[model samples]
Target: WDFLESPGTDEVLYGGAKYGGKSWFLCVWSYLRACAFAKKHKIPKSSHPLKVGFLGRKVAKMFRETTLDTWFKTIPADGYVAKGNPTEIIIDDRVKILTGGFDNRELVNKFNSAEFAFFAVDQAEELTRDEMALLRLATFGRLVVNEKAIPGKGLLTANPRHCWLKDEFILNPIKQRKFVSALPTDNPYCTQKYIDNLIDSLKHRPKLLAAYRYGNWDVLEDAEQVIMDSWLESALNRHGEYWPFVKEYIAIDCARFGDDETVILLMNNTDIKEKIVMPYCRTTEISGRAAALSHQNNDCELVVESIGSDLGAGVVDELTELGHSVLVYTPQGKSSEPDKYYNCRAEAWSKTAKVLCSGVIDEDSNCFVALTKRGEGDNYGLDDTMRGQLCTPHYKWVRGKIVIEPKEDIKDKLGRSPDHADAYVIAVWAWPFISMPNKSGSVRHRKRQKSPMSM
Candidate 1:
């Protein structure tokens, strides 16, 4: 099947679940275009070579090991030759396929000078907004297929993630093009047994099944924990929980300097229950000392910590003066043990994740209740924390501790503090103390009652 019946004039987005023929279609399109270009140019069998560039995210090696490798195997052996070095392939003596991940700007730039009849972005969702814009500009006025003078057009295949392209590129009202969603069902290659297995897997793992098996973007939006408005509601609900007898409370402070919102979580824990007294997050200009002092408590301890990068030790003096026990933890050099970091965050988040995932938190907590109502089935509130803490690299747990190692290159490139996520790690670390313990007498009585019932 010809995926691109008409090229150059229109933008094509082939997005859906895993094993959908999006990548297959892309490979076929590139292969055919290379052959067509050679034939149209009347190049002798070994004379004319068509050059094609394939771009992926910075983590393209992972892509190569997975999707790109699959594409390589799918292509007929007669027409393609895989190079020993990378995903690069020599096709038909007259065509060259250059494969690159988005990490190298220089490699992407190389395509700007060469005139290629076809350009393909394998996993378009992985590209940042700026990178996508650059790719668009690079392909302008370059695609010429057949005798027909066609403008340069590119093909994008991706599973929708939280991004601007979903709004601007796919759902844009101005673009008069059809948006086709190709599910696993749409692909003849996928078997019914495979589909059944996917459905079964999704029943147990909704998030992965939602993203990879169903190709449902709603799942992505709804499964998120921290929507902007929901976050605001949760933050504002902090004031509503103030009780007159709520003394000797603990505050877990997750500080951010700029761009990142400093999150301060206040909790009142008794023997029976723990209540969130306040959860305030905002971008404040307070120095480290001022921020440390602002959230101090006379009767309670302060878990003031740092992650991503150490702001400074100025907060220690201020926190100590307030008659509070201050604990400062640096996440750097800790993430080398992936199991520890993963387990710590998992344990912390599990307390809340259960509520969020099962939609139970939506019932008991008015903060989450109001937020979910405002979200209209979108889980942006939950998603924020998930994306920040869960999606951020180096959050993997090795044993049971939370570890965070800095990626200087990523930090430099992204130009923002991963502090929001750092604050989450701090919150997770503080989770054990946040909840109130059950009364020992109540537990003993319950055990006695259960013994009589069992008898």
Candidate 2:
């Protein structure tokens, strides 16, 4: 609390175990700022209004329900009255707090020009680096009243996740700041019994317990990789044969020689659903794996082959003989123009990761299930495949939209060759066919629209 009130600190990161008073602290800070602005600005006590923005990713509604609702209850009934959307709050006409989701780009831009005495971001880990950078720049310049001082600072409360913020903001040399670690025990209002009960409930759920109870970023139990659990869950929920209704289906094939598993990932462009119908561990011959692919939805046309060596080429030939369209891609020579190695493979992996993180891909289905079941521990062929597909090089956008440049080094350096990695490349290659048109009517339309499968 003291550090928050202190001046000169431009950025603050409050991360720790969940059930802590982090959310409450943000509420208090915002309320105090609103009250201060009301008193100092000399606008009528009734008419003085301060605008504050709260941002989140998926649980926008949940955030409002928990934090914003709790905040209102904490304030005396006579001091403030609830108004506007439940996601937003109008406190005694002195403060207008707006809640927004990160997925809605237009809504996020609303804060770009508006000045507020305070700004808060809940679940800061969910925000993209681009979004954070935009908010930072927007909050620059003079305040609404004080033409000299910056309008207001921003507060970020989140459970630590594997993200750039861990490196850029928290560890950045320029931002001389301190991080406050809060635990469930820190909340004076909550009882020990209550905290214990909550912890006990999450004991069986390693990921949740690690994130919410223990505040450990390294603990990702269910997912073999670091992809968000929500993304994985959503994918699983949307899986079915109806997935073929999408425009394109691309399969990425990563072959395994010895203890490794040969994985095949089937992806459709429409809803971004992926199915790992074939993930065979300790497989040598490609013929058995080829038999598995034969069982997948046959309507999808295109297979992207991640060319590795002579053995990989043989597998591709076997797949081709099965009457499937295939595109063979090999790594560009180290001296090839920009970078050596397969640029397409690298781009495909990067694109796949972006889609997963953006919550665009659905993982719940035969594909994910097969991959997880086959790839376990030190023999994480499928696991490495997924990570390679999801971890792409992203550019930092200080202002406006940022374009991501592909990285060859990242593709080459990632450990192990994954059959699922091949599937990721295939999925990305087929992405354009699946993407839905923007509401704004920005692009040309493709004539063929595939039918969706039953969920």
Candidate 3:
């Protein structure tokens, strides 16, 4: 109650394992907050009754499915008169209980014009941090509300989810905002037999059981994920710039068939600025190179600080003939850090992973849809397809060296080559140009690649 009762506390989160009595606590406490004023002052004012609201993602499911049975068992039928589609309970003729749903834009908007003395939400993790901020707006403009007459506060309860709730209340906590850990064991009402049966049913699912039984947040990892969700979320939508020992390049993953599109990633260090995805035929048309010179012109017109391609079959010869500099990725080539990585690509991607996970995830960010701008303080725009490709590849250790999941496996996982993200990794690596210090305190680079076409 430190967070709810403290003068400094305006927000508090009570979350952890399921069946930790989160729903019950919210219900019972909400009743107390509603009826406390009249109980304290026996002769209550007939004029302004106290008002409290409870909300969640869906009004129907929360009220009809989950809270319906519990609400009847807790609040006496004689004390509160309840009614309606929006759901309300009038208590002792001195308080009004309002329930709201924030599952959709229209639903959340209904609350915009309304005000409440106090508010509480269940499963707060299902909503984003921005949505919670709007909920806090309930406390504003209650100048007439007597302090003892109506004390408005915000409360949230959720299962341990890998989202903003963990970011604000668990990992980095402020004194004013409290985080109380509630395990299923903490509830006396939960019988030992019930806990045993729940644990037994989840025995085969380790990650899930850990969260449900012990509330272990660390157990959440998608086995097929190459790029972490938080890392991708932050980088994709992130703003501003940092001193990054900047470098620039374009890495192309050329398409061999009519169906696939050649992907070009424009990057500054590890940060992507743009992606150019076009079929060979389309590119030739756009470059206006007719007849035999069409392919060569199309290749040269890419214009980047530097260019590298995985397809060296003809682009290396074509671009070099056009007096354009180009490098080629040799996947099986020996690694600069042979002991730590299996091949040059593995070493490069290993470095890419470090750079990607450098920052924390920002919640409720418009990053997934933002238009990608170039140069300082910008990021390449990302769509759902790009996000799926970026997050699809997972890595594993073979003989103590990091190896990216196989091409065929990744194709199966993402339904296509991770062409955009692969080219992005190469562009960011910009191999042999700059080196970042590794854990062992060594700067590494592949042995210089031999000339494919001598100047």
Best model number under lDDT: 3
Q: Could you give candidate 2's per-residue lDDT for residues 166-211 as a string of tens digits? A: 6665555355455677677788875666556545533334565566
- TM-score for predicted model 2 compared with the true structure: 0.47
Q: Give the TM-score of candidate 3.
A: 0.47
Cα lDDT over the full model 1: 0.48
Deviation in Å, model 3, residue 234 alpha carbon: 30
Cα lDDT of model 3 by residue, 1-455, tens digit? 65687777767788877678777778777777778745654525444455555545433454455554466677788977777656667777777677756754665785676566667787686577788877666554431344443445778877666778888888887776788877887877877765665555344345655776676666565622456656766664554433323333456666655665566665444444456676744433322221122243232222222123323345555555656556656666777777656677776666665556554211232112112323332234454566667677765433224567666667876777676666666655563353332223222211122244421
lDDT of each: 0.48, 0.51, 0.58
Candidate 1, residue 144: how far the Cα is off, in Å: 6.6
Superposed model 3: Cα runs more than 4 Å off? 38-50, 55-59, 104-107, 140-143, 146-151, 221-455
Candidate 1 lDDT over 377-415, as tens digits, reads: 331233344244434342211111322333443355446
Regions of model 1 farther than 4 Å from truth? 1-3, 7-9, 45-48, 53-58, 84-86, 143-150, 161-164, 167-170, 173-178, 188-455
Ranking of candidates on lDDT, top first: 3, 2, 1
- The clash count for each model shown is 28, 19, 2
